[model samples]
Target: MHGPDVSWYLALSGLMFTIGAIGVLVRRSPLIILLSVEIMLNGANLALIAFARHFGHADGQVFAIAVMAVAASEVVVGLGLIVAMGRRNIELDVDKLRTLRG
Candidate 1:
């Protein structure tokens, strides 16, 4: 049986990306920004896999894997920084982080 059309996948991906963008723009917490970035990455990944399936090729899947790897590394580094900030009793708000400027 046939699955959902590519357009449906694209619509979902667009919606996810839009939500993530909005979260990043409206939220002041660094943690929320990181999560939103992850969501955007996931949305891109979904579009990549969907296109790969539509084209019957592995290239999109390969790129999606690469994106996932990058996203994982980003999360690791982001969480590490967040933890370090917490240990130092620093505010978690993104606006407050500007004080970190030398």
Candidate 2:
């Protein structure tokens, strides 16, 4: 059956996802990098919602909701750590978070 204009949405989401990934990779600030990761998650969520609306399936929508919840939890925990780092010491640089030190 013929469908809605979902290709554009998918393309836009793809671009957004790529941008977010690139931002995460290229950025030097931990805060910006975390926000970029969130953007990537949101991009995937947008695509899932579009597919759900286009294919008339509730599963994708449900999955999207789950992703959102996970993303929110991640934001809470991740931002708490960032704030903690900021309060305890200066950690504006992404490389400053050297948790995997030997």
What's model 1's TM-score?
A: 0.92
Write model 1 residue lDDT over 51-88, tens digit each, in one string.
99999999999999999999999999999999999999
Identify the runs in model 1 with alpha carbons over 4 angstroms from their true place: 100-102
Cα lDDT tens digits for candidate 2, 8-64: 889989999999999999998878988999999989998998899888998999999
Give the Å shift of residue 19 in candidate 1: 0.4
Worst 10 residues of 2 by lDDT: 93-102
Instruction: Give the Å shift of residue 23 in candidate 2.
Output: 1.0
Off by over 4 Å in 2: 1-4, 99-102
Q: How does each model score on TM-score?
A: 0.92, 0.87
Q: List the residue pairs that clash in candidate 1.
A: none
What is the Cα-based lDDT of residue 42 in candidate 2? 88
Q: Weakest 10 consecutive residues, lDDT, candidate 1?
A: 93-102
